[model samples]
Target chain A: MFLITNEPLSVTEVEAVVADPGAGALVTFTGVVRDNNLGKSVHYLEYEGHPPMAEKAMAQIGDEVTARWPGARVAMAHRLGRLDIGEASVIISVSTPHRADAFAACQYAIDRLKEIVPVWKKEVWEGGEYWIEGSTAAS
Target chain B: MITVQVQLFAAYREAVGARQVPFDVPQGATVLDVWQQLQATYPKLRTPRPVAAINDAYATLDTVVQPGDLIAYLPPVSGGRSLIPSPSGEG
Candidate 1:
């Protein structure tokens, strides 16, 4: 399951999608807004994206995990709009028959989400705000 | 003239002061041409070379613009990395 929402993210919501009786391990990762970045104290964060394309890209990541590990199930979601510091911005969960596969797939899911997803974040710091230029993905 | 919608994100959105805008370009104008027009209108938009998307799919600067096309200008992406091959040749 892949989703994009403006509401706060719920870890249980994502974990439920990866619930599998046959799976031996489930790994979940949540990316939270931090209080500092690049030596600057961040006050808050604003996230925005082309919701349709972002969700489509997220689903593609799920498909990739299944193709690589046939037994793995992936669930991921990203929150859009303003989020206070320490709030979860993204949540990813993966289930597989082995702990190693579950862990690996979960890592891969988050990395791919960062590279291909259309989401962008603006850091509102003490003095001013700036849009972060993280990856140079032209698409 | 062919009209197309330009969708901006992040800094590009702030530069143009709107999330989306409409532009009327000359016939046979390409995606790059539309971007040039935008730069002319909002010089601040020249900060980054954003990835272009034509109608929700990845596109190149050389891609031809069609009437009523929606061209999205995406700023640099953060954190997310694609394992698959992207149109821009990045991972």
Candidate 2:
């Protein structure tokens, strides 16, 4: 269920794809837009992505999780375009036979998604806006 | 010469003022060549090197560019709290 959409994301939708009868636990992670960043009051965020490549990267992450945790199933969805504060921007669901595996796999998915996904975000504030590059180093 | 489509996003898109552009490069030119040419054309593209993908797959800068290929130069990335956490746990 790796997906990229301009519409709002739903955790239930993503979780349904990873539902497994053998699974005892399902862990989900939702990344939401915040109102403040770097001490500036954020107005909103605009997400842009290469849809095909982004989904490819996400599916690759799922494959990694499956290989790392043999019984785990993973599904993810990421939303694009203008998103206001508190809106869900991304969701990752992982189901596994044990709670530990489900939790670990779910965290790993989000971390890898941030690292490899071909998506970018722009933070717009009251007076200005800046593209977030996810690097702390000066650009 | 070969022509490839260069896709830019985020800062790269704003810097170049175009979402995508068609570029011409000599045969056997690598992705690095395309980056250099873009830098020469748009000095505002300040990032020295960014991750590149060829035809929707991750590629090294040295990877050869193919005619009609869709090449994307990604700025860092977004989402997640922080890319690097402080070792000392103090800001």
Candidate 3:
């Protein structure tokens, strides 16, 4: 599944999609708005993405997953606009027959999204906000 | 003839002085044509930015544009949360 939403995402929502009988393992990752970064207190986070480009990139990622794991199920959602503190900005869930595939594929999806998707994350910090470009962050 | 709506985001929106630009190209005008026309019509676009995207993925002049297709013009993703309003590639 590929989605772009403004609604707050929940683990339950993700579990609903991943609770498949055939899959033995489910892996999910959520990127939240951290309260502090670079020694500043963050108020909120704004996730800006090139909708058209980002959507296309997401669909392509799904295709890549299918190619790698023939029968695996993949779902991804990204939140846009201003997100309050502790809110999930992005979530990815993957279900595969094996635990290793589930872990690897889930990591692949999130990493690829960070690397290629035209999404930008801005940290709304105390006094003023700044876009966080954590060098260690995956695409 | 087909009309494709292209939205400019961030720097592109500011440079063009507008949010969305409508390109009414001949029916079956490839995405490339729309891009070239933007440059041609707006001499200011003579210096094209990085790559362009059609319906999301990276596209070139060769990509086709449909009547209702929404194309996006994206600049490199930086930390700036460009509050440029609509017609930004994301809208």
DockQ of 3: 0.16
What Cα-based lDDT does every candidate model obtain? 0.85, 0.86, 0.70
Superposition-based RMSD of candidate 3 using all C-alpha atoms, in angstroms: 7.1
lDDT of 3 at A29: 87
Clashes of each: 6, 0, 6
Off by over 4 Å in 1: A135-139, B47-49, B80-91
Q: How accurate is candidate 1 locally (lDDT)?
A: 0.85
Per-residue lDDT of model 3, residues A1-139, tens digit only: 5777778887778767767899998889888777766566778877777765677667777777767877678888888889988788888998888899988888878766765667766666657655444252322
How would you class the docking of model 3? incorrect
Off by over 4 Å in 2: A137-139, B79-91
Q: Pick the candidate with the highest DockQ.
A: 1
> DockQ-based ranking, best first?
1, 2, 3
lDDT of 3 at B48: 52
Model 2 chain A weakest 10-residue run by lDDT = A130-139
- Give the CA lDDT, 0 to 100, for residue A96 in model 2: 98
lDDT of 3 by residue, B1-91 (tens): 7888887765456568776877788887876677677877766665454456666556665777878888777655543233222231221
Query: lDDT tens digits, residues B1-91, model 2?
Result: 9999999988999999999999999999999999999999999988776778888777888999889999998887765433222233222
**Which residue pairs of candidate 2 clash?**
none
